[model samples]
Target: MTRPSLLAAIAIASLSTITTGAFAADQLVVASFGGAYTASQSKAFIEPYMAEKGAKVLTADYNGGLAELRSQVQSGNGAWDVIDLELQDALRACDDGLIEKIDASQLAPAADGTAAADDFLPGTLMDCGVGTIMWSNIIAYDKTKFQNGGPKTIADFFDLEKFPGKRGLSNKPNVNLEWALMADGVPNDKIYETLATEEGLNRAFAKLDTIKKDAVFWGAHAQAPQLLADGEVVMTAAANGRIYDAISKEHKPFEIVWDGQIWNLDVWAISKASKNKDAALDFVKFSTTGPRLADVTKYISYGPVRKSSQGLVPEAIRTNLPTYETNFKTSLANDLEFWADHQDEINQRWATWMAK
Candidate 1:
């Protein structure tokens, strides 16, 4: 071949290499709490987005917290482009400038053309993050554990003489404090207000003290269901989705007690330091559409945050969601603002209580 022809061939090869390198770098890394929750997201969001956009996606799982996200941001080498955060963590991360500010205007509207901002449930759309799903923490008991009707209320959870078995509780103080306050006779509307004072704090701990010895504390989402399945704890505080998966898929004889259930939102936020910020934001937009949000319910029991998505969910799945009328009757929405202000102090106290 002539020298000119050889040069042309070399140029084509170099261009192909550059294009491949750029395409590889365009992939987005998303992080979230693992287990059935992530599985639902994989089916409902990630896989579909990749297929539609021809983009590469990677996933990382972390038991929920701000420590790993903080480390990544502070070090200026963020490994995750998109992160799924509990509402309080999202608030704190946004305040500390750890995540990118999202523009709600860019989100897709409802099928009927309602604005995205107005379509989302109140308190879900934030400056830095967009809410994805609403999930709840509730008491799950083995149906076979008690011949008599099992725990029926939050108060029953603390009654050792009546329930007569080891209890499973999350190691975190968030829901436990609220449940303690509720079980101790504080009214639902007064829960956070009651927990704000010194006397209230002591009262919660004192109520918790009633079952500390018999309580088995679990730190991860999966552990709650496993504790009950393994018979380590007769009843455990579990994510509703996890318990639903165990019952529906594994055919476990577990039942969820929705009384005094504490529900919260999981938000999607972009890392401030992500090299793929644009791609990350695009994925977030795509995943949060009403159709996509509703699709998640087909896999897990979590309720979609979009008001429009509610209609998309079938009646069978809708009835099992946390937002279902019967299930939500006695539920309490977690106060993200309260946790944002009090998490550090509460965590410190939680550690002390755990030690004792």
Candidate 2:
């Protein structure tokens, strides 16, 4: 071949390589609850998904609220492509048309070939969100505070006379209302039923009033553990994962109380305004599947949403998981639908109650 023709051919080849590399390395942003939870997600899902899809997964952190997402959607400026949020937030976002409706058929099936619909634990799959983990709101106490034995039940948490310490609770109404009713002798099965009525609502608030004077309210998941550790409060209602990190990583004197634990699902959803919708969908599908979901447990104790993923979790950590045999038996599922319907009313009431 002529020298000029050979030089042109070399230029064409180099251009092709550069274009192909650019297409192969797509990037997406995932917003999640930060700290140890985000770290676990990066290791278990983001890194592996990047390796497989030849994409970059940028991580952002939030305090588990939909305000930022709503702002982006309203302003038409999409910053995050995907988010890890609680089930109730996902439902609200979907209703407000801030998030994309997910096609469950696109989710990866179980290892045994079960369809995604049949494989995901009940209530985990939703209209807009795909649940990734089965986590719980648990009561964690400092072992040093309870020398003989720690508070065991939800009632004990509210009973200052029995447990006898300043308690720490999240500064939200979601799980606190349920815990109050449960502690007030409302049966586990009837928690939502009681919460749904005026009488039930009054009962819960009355119960909360018992401890309101002595309780220390925490605004973040990380703060709950810190409160217990710094001797600010002897006991706190914590996300099971945060307490797990406290005991396992920070070497704090903490033990989780399984009784009255409110189990809930943490889900992933795509923003409707996301420019990278296709890439975000691909990332979500890859992460919530069999091995990937279960792999998160190695870093944190939350159970995988997929039933098939349970077997992949090591037996040693099984007891710590929200789905563990003992823990599962006593826990109540967080009713996201109910919360979705009444969140505004409850929040207003909670604010008023807190102020008084």
- TM-score, one value per model: 0.92, 0.90
In angstroms, give how far residue 249 of model 2 lies from its true place: 1.9
Q: Indicate the worst ten consecutive residues by lDDT in candidate 2.
A: 12-21
Evaluate all candidate structures by whole-model CA lDDT and list the values in order: 0.87, 0.83
Residue 276 lDDT in model 2? 79
lDDT, candidate 1, 212-264, per-residue tens: 99999888998998999999999989999999999988999999999998888
What is the Å distance of residue 189 in model 1 from its true position? Answer: 0.9
How far off is residue 93 in model 2, in Å?
0.9
Candidate 2: list runs displaced more than 4 Å: 1-24
Model 1 reaches what TM-score against the true structure?
0.92
Candidate 2 lDDT over 1-356, as tens digits, reads: 01112112211011110001123256799999887899999999999988887798899888888889999999989899999988777767877988887777777888778988778776677777788997889999999997789888888898898789899988999899999998889898888878999999999999999998889998878789888988999999999999998899889989999998887778898997787787888788889898999899999999897888888888998988887888877788776657866888999999999898
**Total clashing pairs in model 2:** 0
lDDT of 2: 0.83
